[model samples]
Each structure stands twice: as C-alpha cells, then as structure tokens.
Target: MTMDGGRALVLGGGGVAGIAWEAGLVAGLAGRGVDLAAADVFVGTSAGSVVGAFLAHGGDLEQAIEIMSARPDGDPAARPPKPDMDLVMTAFALMYDTTLEPREARARIGRMARETPTDGRGAALEEIGRRLPSPKWPDRHLLVTGVDADDGSFVVWDRDGDASLEAAVRASCSVPCVFPTVEIGGRHYMDGGVHSMTNADLVEGASTVVVLEPLAHFTPRDRLERELKTLGDARTVVVGPDQAAIDAFGVDVLSMRLWGPGFRAGLAQAPAVAAQVQEVWAGA
Candidate 1:
C-alpha cells in the first residue's frame, strides 16, 4: 500500500452513525500525517439528531440543518458547505422507518406516494403526485433515504417498498457510492437483499469503495470471506463492529460501537490506513 494523500471513502453515511464515522476518519487521517478528503450518501430523516451529530463531528451543522429543513435548492449540491469534509458526500441522505409494521410494506409505499414533494427533486416530487394505494394490508418498509433536502446536490429518494431504491440512488448520486459487503475466511458473499455495487465499475476509477458493516437484518459471514479473496491483494480495511470482530476478519478492524469516543480513537489512527493507498487521485 502506498501512502500519500489519498481520499478516504465513507459508505452508508446517512445518519449520526455515518457522520460520526466520517469525522473519526478525518481525525484519523490527520493523526496519520495525511490530509484526508471524505464523502457519503445521505439517505435518511431530517431530524435534528442527524444534523446535530454532523455539527459535533466538525461539520457546518447549522447550515446542513437549514438546507434540510427548507428545500431552497433545485439541486441539493448547490448549497454551501455544511458538514464539509475534505470530499463531497453523495447520493441519498438518511434512512427512516415509514411504517410501524414492516411486514405490511405495501401500505407504507402508498403513504410515501401520497405525501407532497416538500423537497424539490423533480422526479421524486412527480412520483409522489401520481401515487396509488397498494392492494395490501398494513404495509411495512425500510426507509434507506430521507425526504429532507438539506444537501443541495443530492436528489433524495425514499426506499419504501422497493429495496432496489438503494441501487437506484447510488447510480444517480454525484459522488461515488460505497455499498458494504462482508468477507469471512477468504470467502465473499452478497445476499440478494444486501445493497452492493460492482467492483469492476469501481476499479475503473469510480471513486467508490464498499465497507461492510454490521446489520441487524441479516448474516452471511462465509460469503463475505469468499468475496475478499477475489480482491487479490487490494488494499482493504475491515472496520469491526467492535475490536474483537476485527480479529475475526484478519484485517485492521476499527471498533465502530464506541460512537463518540471510539471514533476519536479511530481518527487518531487514520494515517496508518491512508499510508497504504498506492495512488492519490481525484473523483469527478
């Protein structure tokens, strides 16, 4: 691994957890004698918690909060720097639970369609205007993106009924999208339900890297290992849900469970990771 000033890529940066990770990563690079640039896909609620976390993590929290509360820009990317990392975060913002009962996923989609496009994305606003009720009972769905349009560049979408919305948002976003995948004991796996991007596209200078994180919904440890073997000596870092899990991956795993303090420790160790990057290139 060659270390110069390569950009630090952050995937799944939509909520407080994402912001915290970005901040920690930034701080880590600084500690490692590296100048770090960062980005993410915000795809969740516009609640104060997300903004507050960004502020606490050294971002322009106030501005980010304002943009989210008011859909002032036709394109979210046009907004000024708030929570400005060295690089730009892209795609969706945060995830929210649209329905109380996830089993009734169809009903939740109906509600999303009924709501107005308070945020200014043309396609999303138009879709909501033409929505119809689902022929199902109390619907439940997972919200991978939020309705809040705080970021000027991103076109936020709700992953209510369609799990594929995750991929759609990734394809549309301005910044490279990072979709997490797991590897265990030299094998890699991607379940149909898990959101992932192709390495072929990314390797061609797409500016995206997928970092596998812990999921409450599913597990595929054996598959994860197979996937890593395919990388064949690519510089990869395994950020553990905790320090112990790091050992299981046989890679450097930064414990993510220690939200505030753990992040601080990780930030202090960034240079070690950045030093390993072989190239320093900019993304479009």
Candidate 2:
C-alpha cells in the first residue's frame, strides 16, 4: 500500500534506553536543521511509536527526552518491574538452539511471550499517549503497528481508525512478556516488533522514507532487506546504532540504566547520517 503523501518517516522499536537514543537523534537532527516532523506519513512500531506520536503531535523534543530518559525505578509515576531475567535467558537460549524445528521454536516462543506478568512499564506510555493531541494533526498521517497475540496476525492502526491513539500506541509498545497484551476492540494486541521492528513496507508508494532504527543490528536481515526491496523506487535512508552506539546503549532492551549513554550515542552518530538524510529530503 502507498502512503497518502509522497514522503514517509519510519521508526523502529527499541526498549527503554532506545527511547533516549531516538530522542537524541531527533535533537541532533534538529540541531542540523533537519526537521522530520514535516513528513507526510509516520510508521512506528514499539518504542518507535512513542517517538512517532510525539512527532506527529508536535511535542517538544527536549521534553520527550527528559520523560523517556527517566529511570523506571526512580520515577514516581512508574512502577516498572525489574527485567524478566528468566525470560531473557530463555529467549536467548531458544534463539541459539539450532536443534529445534522452526515450528517447535515458534511454539516455545509463543508460550514464553504470554507467561510473564505485565511489569507495568506500559503505564508511562499510556500516560504519554493520552496526553498527546486527541484528534491528532489533520495534515499528518500516522500508522502504528502491533501484533495480535491470539492469532499471531500483524495489525496496523492508522490515525483515522476507530481505535484511540492511546490504545494503538499502548498496544504497539506492549513488548511481549515485559508488558501485558492489550485488548482493544476484541483483539489481544502486543508489540509489532515481534513481526517487523520497522514496518517500512507499509508506506510502499512514498517517494522517500527515512528509517530511524535503534535495534537495526538485531533485526532479521532478510526481513529488513525484503521490506526495502518492496519499497521499489522509493529513496530510503536508514540511521541506526553503530557498534559504538550499541555498546553504549547496551544490548539489554529492557534495561533503563543506560539512557544517558544511549542519548549520547545517538548524538555522536547523527552527523554521519545527517548529510544523507538532507540529500534525500532535498531531492524528495
């Protein structure tokens, strides 16, 4: 499907620290005089959706950084549970075990996805979503992605859809096992990152697409490559965490301790990609 407008901005999911990184990227881009909020369409999955919402509504960049950068344990408004260490370890084990058949591995992952209690990290997201513009800016189009927990189907919530923006973003950011699956309009929804961390393909007809991905290294290569291939002639620019940035942010997506480093990493990485982004946008 094609985006209504010629340009699209895509955001990829990353956990707590990821928010900081993306915000930093936003700030860095702003400093470079690159304003991404002008994009015609926005596609966001998981943590990406949170930032996308802010951009869609014209929220303050520094304010978003401050809010997302808060340590969950220390934030009075948040009651996030500690990282589910067992789930993390088990997930890694399942991913590395080549002995299991694809079907069996999928089954195990499905089970693991639902077994953990909702750790309450989502409360902040819900709060943020609620505080965003209710009707949203009419000129902008937003697409928030999520996955249906029961049927394992991919879901895309558009700004014009019946679902409230809050519900859509909440479901999109609901990382399986870390946050509870959201039930909206009879469907149980969870993180769309399970399917594609950056659903860039959704805006197939756009003339240009800018993808800001925090977990680019971890995303399946085939999936991202295929999505880019599907974009056909659209000019696509991607900026993601390099090795140094990834090291600074830490690989633990659920951790909240390294937001400062994550933000700094994004700031450091921005200049290298700024020219590419400027060229694409100018050409678009």
Candidate 3:
C-alpha cells in the first residue's frame, strides 16, 4: 500500500477495543499530519458499548464511563482500560466456551453487520456487509482459504487485493484491519489495494488467497508466497502467524503484532506494530 495521505479504518468492537479506537488514533495522528484515518465496526450491544465509550470519551477513560453510564443497566466492570478496547472479545470468549458455537457467532456477526452502516467514512463502513454470502465458501465470503503441511498442517488467507474482505476478516477475527486512506504517528500507511474490497473479493484477486487447516482458517506460508507473487504490481505485507511460512514462499515479509492471545496485549502492541509497518513502507 502507498503511505501517502492514506487512511487506516478499523472495524468491529465487541471483544476488544474495536476498530473505532484504532481509527481514532490514526485520525488523531492524521489530524496532526500523520496521514491516517481509523474506524470501528460495532456488531451488538457489547460492540455498541465500545463505540459509545470511544465516541463519548474520545478515548478518555472519564468520558467513556460518563457515556457508558447513560446506557441503562450498564456495568462498569465490562469497561476496559482506556487503551485495552477491541472487537475480538467475542472471538476470545467463544474460544473459551465449550460449545464452540461458530454458527451462533456467525449469526451474531450477521446481525452486527446488518446493524452497522454501509456507507460513509470511518466506523460507518463496518456496516457495509449487511448481507454477505455464506462464510463457508470463498464465493460467498470475502476471503479465500488454503491449507498446507510441513511437520504439521495449517491454513492461511491473504488480505492482498480486497480491502473490504480484509476489513471483514479484521472485524470477524477481531484484528485491526487498517486502511491507507488513514494515518497514524504523522506517517502514512495503507492496506495496499485490498483496502476497499472485502475479504471475499480479495480471495478472487490472488492465487491461493485463503488457507484452511484441520481446525482453523487463515493465512498460511505457501499462500502468502502465492499472494505476493500475484501482487507483483504492488507492495504487500503479511501479518499474523506463520512467519516461517512467509519465508517458505520467498516473499518479502515483515512481522507485526496484530494477533495473539488477547485484545489487551494486541491493543498495547498495535500502535508500535503499525508504526513499524509504516516505517518499512516509507523506506520502500
């Protein structure tokens, strides 16, 4: 992605701080000449709480509480630290549940996507997918899936050509799906060509765009290489696990702290990670 006067829209707000806060940070930086814009896509009551907190407090704790209190029967304990908000809380919570209710989560995501707005800037775009195809198929979903094995097997999905799918995946996976029309830290960073398209469209744009394994679906090593090769006309960066997988594909790769155990940790690390990516892109 080009790093000049771009935006970094974030989506989803149920589990972690959500994309809104990330968008706010980028916007804040952009306002000061950072060249970034951030947004959050809210999917439910929980997500509503996060978006409400950010909108009410401007990322300030005191303001967030004041806004949250306006909601009837709101619980203070549900609130995160001023910096620890994100959309992946639902995913993490689902992980802990013995039921492993992907279907329920899917339904909730559908509802949340429907409740959000389909147009406008920043948080508004999270609502774009009010009616998405079945998540089970690449044709129906925004991202594609691929699987491979070394000593073990894994899945991978790339956010290379389609930004909307990247946004959807970022929202669905609770990772911050940043964009190029946004800015952060006075530097400009963009999600390349994939910033405007959805993950489903992204799958169609690249070779081996999505990877599915026995238990999970995401970007795997071989798939990353294929995507990079397919994206010869543009610069690209792959985030998440399978660093070695990127190497396996002989693709230029930089690691960022966009995934891991929880939202708090990821939130704490995202700014720095984003900065690093920005720096690399600037130099390139």
Candidate 4:
C-alpha cells in the first residue's frame, strides 16, 4: 500500500482478549520503528477505545499493556458489590401489574433501579479512564465510535466534541446488555462494535491507514470485509493474529489466558510486516 501523507490508525473491538492482542500489535509495531500512536488520526471502537484513549493522550505502550492485562476481576477491592436479587425480582413483579398506575409502577421500578448496585463496570471503566485522557486534554484528532441504542445510528466522538473523553470511551466500550448503556446529550449509546468491528471506514481521508483487528482473524463478518475493502481502495494494511496465535488463545473474549500469547504474537508479527508498513508509510 502507498500513501500520500496523513496516517490513521484504527483499533477494532475485541474483548478482554482483544485488548491483549491490540496491545501486543501496537507494541510490536513500535519495536520495529512503526509507532502507531504517532499517527495523525486514531479511530477506536470498543476495547480499542480503551487503548486508543491512552495513546491519544501521550500514554505509552508499556502503560497500556500493564493496565490492559491486569486482572481486575480478581481483586475484591476493585470489584463492585453484586446487585440485590430481591430488588431485581420486585422490579420484575412490578412489570406484570397490568392494572397498576403507570406513574406508580414507573416510580417503583426507578427506585429499585436506584437501589440496585452496579456490577463494577462503571468502576472498571473509571479506573481505566484514570490512566487515559481527561476531557480535551491535548486536542488530538481522536475519534471514538459508539452505536445509539434508540435508533441504531453510528456515533463518533471527536476530541473537540462536548462529550468528555471518558464519557465517549465509556459509551464506546459499553457492551449491549453486559454493561450499562451510557447517556450523552440525552441519548443512550452502546458498543460501537454493534455497527463496525474495527471501524476502518473512519479512515476515509487519511492517505494511509493501519488497522489492528483482533476479531477478524477468527470471527469473520461481512461488515468487517466491506470496511476493509473500503480502506484497501485507498492505502491500508490490516494486521490480525495468525493461526499459531489463535491456537495459543482460544476464541473466548472474556478469558484472560490469551493476554501473553496475544502480546507475544504482536511482537512476533511486527518484524514480518515492518518493511511493508514502512513502504506504505513512505509511499514507495
């Protein structure tokens, strides 16, 4: 791939495992003198948004790797208390009362919802956000993607936008039912992966783009293919885990077992493509 000038880096949504993979790939590229964080623009979806936020605000690869690989679930102090099942059941019962006044039911349900504790997702995102940029920290051209739940429209958050970097990243990382939907400007939003896995399409005007895709290696999707095709039409290179890496880390997104393999795979894969990446960057 040959480029004219500007470079964009796109990070796709995987999960916990995806995070490890992306971290590895970025670090690997950096080792080979291809610093993805130095790109003119950055586009992140789900897990990508987590890593992207860090890189966008002058964070380093080692920091990203350390934070992303940490086992947050294992720490009791870090984990949020579980929701009261009794309160959840009461809310469910309230839903079945056909004759109950709408106002009363709504009030009751809202109260129960308030009483119910968050499952630590908010806290986790907060902790991760702490390591990344705050609102408009450096004015980088960072774009975070999310999907509006109300109408299924794709959302992109830029640094100059009103939404804080944390809010946008939270919205972008919020998986449908697993994590709470984030509300920004009165609209509910969820994971950007619902619309595009890596969001390579966002790199439209960049002369060259590098896509770090964690899911496309095993879980193929037509949407992803179309996005890649669009990037290919311009000048783009896609990197994903090879078969050995896949074998080392299974397809379980939530499993922490893949972190090491993913990281190593990234380092290993970088050398092979370093020259090609340089050529693409140089438009040789």
Candidate 5:
C-alpha cells in the first residue's frame, strides 16, 4: 500500500465547485513552482478526473488553474438556462465550460456524447478527448474513473489512450441524465462519484496519499477517514472546504446556484490550501 518513501496525490471529486476548489490548490502549487516526488499515481473521480489527467501529463499548475477557474462575469442566475446565442462552442471554450458551468458544458459534451461510431469507434469523441490535456505525453500512469450506466459499476482506466481514453473521462464527468451517457467499446457510462467521492481504491504503490476534497462540511469527515484507513496500508490526508465555506455556498437540492457564481467564494481559499500542502509536504 505504501510506496515507502514515494508519495501519491489524488485529486478528490467535486461536481462543478469541486473542480474549481481543486483548481485553487493547483494555482497555489503553480505560484510556488514546486513539484511532488516521483512514481506517484494520480487517481481522480468525476471532476477530479478532469483535473487529475492534466497533472498526470505533467501539466502546468498555473495554466491548468486558469482553465479550470472559468466563470461567468456576473450573476450565474442571470446567465441563460437556454441561451439564444449560437449553441456551437469552440473546442477551447467547450473544454473548460463543461466543468465550469456544467449545464452549458453539457450541451457541448452532448454533441460528442452520442457521436456516430466509425468501425466501432466514435471519431468525433476521439478528436475531442485527444485535445483535453495539453502537451500530451506517454507512459503516464493516469486513471480516470467512470461508471457503466447499464450496470451501475465503475469504469476506471486500464491501458487508456487516444479517443477511447477521452471517452472514459467524459463518461466519468457525465452527469446522469443531465448530459447524455457516453459510449466506449459499445457500453454507456456515467459519473464515477455515483459510487464513492474519493474512489481511493485506485491508489496503489504509494506510502503517502494526499486527497483534495470539496465536499460540504456537514459530510461525515471522520467516517470517510475510517473508510480510507481500511482501503490500503498508507498514510491518508484529506483536505476540503470547511463549515464556513460550505455554509457560504448555501447548497440546496436541485439548485444551479451552488455550482455557479457562488463557487467563486470557494476559489478564494486556494492560497491557504497551497500553504497547507507545503506544510504537509514539509512534515512528510
């Protein structure tokens, strides 16, 4: 379970705001220009998978933050639920918008989700997935988790690459019925967080496990820790939004506000998170 002296960082799941909160942590790392040790396996579920893929490819912390931190200029409520403007979004815009404002991004993702398969492959999906992580590289031990919608089982990675890899990621990021289910190898899939927020079972061969979580403060923090304790033989650390921050988000059932402009307050905490990461690394 432990990588002995090695360390692994797992970006935890968040729907809309979770990815933004993770972006703040990444922004902090970018500001410092620091790097974690080698042989670290990065595991992410849902929004975490979207961000973790970049870090796995040795993505720039600051640049990644800029993209993940996308937000509308004013009231999210003011934004169009169904815009009268052009539905067609450029690749760059679609890339970030999907997670930033998932409602809108869903339209963009919807275009590729049901793409026509050519000889058992969805060409459009392949093209979109390939462009996700900037400056792509090989031999990166990356795992993007998803769920098979038919069976409600996890569709995490194994020998992933190209459009198929992107398909897996899109499936993991897909919101059930919000965005259409994505097909890979003839099977449809949905978000992996439907099972567990952390999905720490993907963590292996690391002595230290660092998780970035954006769950509400009212969530069972201690019980989650206990569950991680049983997952593997490693030191686990979970960092997430505090009670005050969660209260500020004012989460409510079936509300778009939580994942919208209200999430900006969540981004405000990035700097402090960087400090905490630094301190944790120092102790390690």
Candidate 6:
C-alpha cells in the first residue's frame, strides 16, 4: 500500500494504549518513508489527539512516537494522588446534578484536581503546539474530539477554535475521575471518549477510515470489525493489539494501565500494524 496518498487517518481514543499503538503505527509508516503530513485528512479522539495534533503541527512520525511513548506520567510521589471509589462515585453523582452529590463531588475533586499535577497530556499538546502556525488547523487537517458539558454531546474540534493547544488536548483526554474537567472560555469540558468511541460516521468525507484499537484481540472485538464495515462509504481498516500483547500490560485502571503499558509493547506492535496497513492503503 502506498503510504502517501489521498488517505484519511481515523484515530481512536483509548487512553495511553491507544496513543502508544497509534504512535508506533505512525513510526512504522515513517520508517517506510511515509510523510504523515501529506496524508489528506486526519481525525483524532481523546488521547489520539496527542498524535494527530502533533502531525497537524508539521511534526514527523518519530516525533509523534516520542511524545506518545514518553514517560510523562512522572514519579508517583510527585504526581497527583490516585482517585479512589469515593472520588469516582462522587463524580458520577455530579454528572447529573451539580447542586447535590455532584456539587459535593465537584468540590472534593476540584481541590484534588488543582493539587494533582497535570496528567502529562497538557505537556504533550503544548510541545506540539509550539511547532504549529496556529492553534486552529488552517483548514480541517486535524480534527479533535470533545463533549459538550451541558448536553453530553460529541463535538469534533478541527483545530479551528481559539482553544489553546493544551486546552484542546486536555478536553479530549479529560477522563472523568482521573482528570478533572477543564474550563475553556467559560464552558466546562471533559473527555470526548464518552461519546465518540466507535462512532466513525462523525467524520464526514473520509475516503477511508483507519481505526487503531489498543485492546484484547478476541471474538468480542471481532464485533468492532463488523460494526466498522458499515461505518461509511469509505474503505475501513481495524487494527487490534497483537494477541500476545493483550496480557502484557494486564487489565487495570486508568493511570499506569493507560500510559505505561504501551511504552514497550507499542514498539513491538508498530511493525505488525505497518504490515496490516499495506492492505488498507492498497486501494487508498
């Protein structure tokens, strides 16, 4: 498959695992001399924004891989305290009513959120933003995902708004209990994954959709393969984690499980994804 062509890259948001796999996939394509910037369209959700935004800024594949694989999670002592069941339950309660349990949850989490250092997502976006001509993509070259705080609706940010690089990434990666919602202008925003997962039709005019999923490679996931078949008129490619890498990181919660697992396994998963993409681009 030709790496450089009229191709549309679809990025999924699965936290660090997604970032790691997609970063490696980009590196693999670059290793074969592909210019990611030349690709016609790019779409990213949640953590996928980390890499997609980087490309929109004219950075190379290695740059994306480095940023995604970087150990930005930091030392445990220096980072924010882990969220407990109380924090999660409180956040859930607050999602519905802001004046009751939700308000209490917000108050509790707000203090912790302010205290805990950023989850490294802001730093990654800022690094790429430095290379960008502007925060908004000149056109729709880089489309990021976000959810409306008021109605819980899905919104795709095409690097068009006045939101800063860090702000956009934070909105996309704002996992409920893990990272607190960010305020942009005056609106409260959280992670986009809540609404955009497997919703590829959200992107219009995509000639082909390339989904990079970082999860178990089992029959249950095969459903995703079938679901994508009808996503759009565009050709579709679904790449799952190498079956061997499933248990590598172990099933766990949001923090280390998201970012840490892919640091090593992602490097290995990249080449395999490279091979899979050959068919994806064969008709691109």
Find the candidate with the highest lDDT and give its number: 2
Residue 65 of model 5 has an lDDT of 40
Whole-model lDDT for model 4 versus the true structure?
Answer: 0.69
The global Cα lDDT (0 to 1) of model 1 is: 0.29
The better candidate by lDDT, 2 or 6, is: 2
lDDT of 1 by residue, 113-222 (tens): 22322233233212211221221211221122222111111122333333233233322221211212112223211111212211111222223333423221123344
Clashes of 6: 3
Cα TM-score per model: 0.32, 0.86, 0.28, 0.76, 0.66, 0.70
What's the TM for model 2?
A: 0.86
Q: Give the alpha carbon lDDT tens digit for every residue of 182-255 in model 2.
A: 87898778777766778889999899889988987875567688899988889889888878888886657666
Where model 5 places Cα greater than 4 Å from the true spot, the runs are 1-5, 30-39, 61-131, 134-138, 158-163, 216-219, 231-233, 243-267, 270-276, 282-284
Q: Write down the TM-score for model 4.
A: 0.76
Per-residue lDDT for 136 in model 4? 55
Give the whole-model CA lDDT for all candidates, comma-separated: 0.29, 0.75, 0.27, 0.69, 0.54, 0.57
Please rank every candidate by TM-score, starting with the best: 2, 4, 6, 5, 1, 3
lDDT value, residue 222 of candidate 2 = 70
Model 2's alpha-carbon lDDT is 0.75
Candidate number with the higher lDDT (4 or 6): 4
Candidate 3's displacement at residue 97, Å, is 23
Model 5 lDDT per residue over 239-278, tens place: 7775545665554311333443324444566555666666
State the RMSD for candidate 5. 9.9
RMSD of each: 16.7, 3.2, 16.2, 8.2, 9.9, 6.7
